[model samples]
Target: MPESGSVELVWLFGPFAVYLVMLGVYYVWEGKREEQLRQRYEEAEHGQ
Candidate 1:
């Protein structure tokens, strides 16, 4: 019974940990994308 509980706990938190990692990756990707867009916009404005 204790082994079963331990396995269940790991199963539950394992997916949660994966989700947190994905969220962190997504957050970083978004920040980088925004920075790139801002730079492009500035370059376009300066070229005109």
Candidate 2:
């Protein structure tokens, strides 16, 4: 059987790692979309 400390460590760190990964992906996706929107707005303003 696994020790309680090891089990607790796994549970704690596992979710944290997953959350960090998800946050990173979200940030990248949001940044790209924002940049695209800004470019489109700029182009529209310039009548391009």
Tell me how candidate 2 scores on lDDT.
0.98
Runs in model 2 deviating more than 4 A are: 1-4
**lDDT (Cα, tens digit) per residue for candidate 2, span 1-48:** 999999999999999999999999999999999999999999999995
Give the Å error, residue 5, model 1. 1.5
lDDT of each: 0.97, 0.98
Q: Which candidate has the top score in lDDT?
A: 2
Per model, state how many residue pairs clash.
Answer: 0, 0
Question: Candidate 1: lDDT over CA atoms?
Answer: 0.97
lDDT of 1 by residue, 1-48 (tens): 578989999999999999999999999999999999999999999999
Candidate 2 clashing pairs, residues 3+ apart or interchain: none
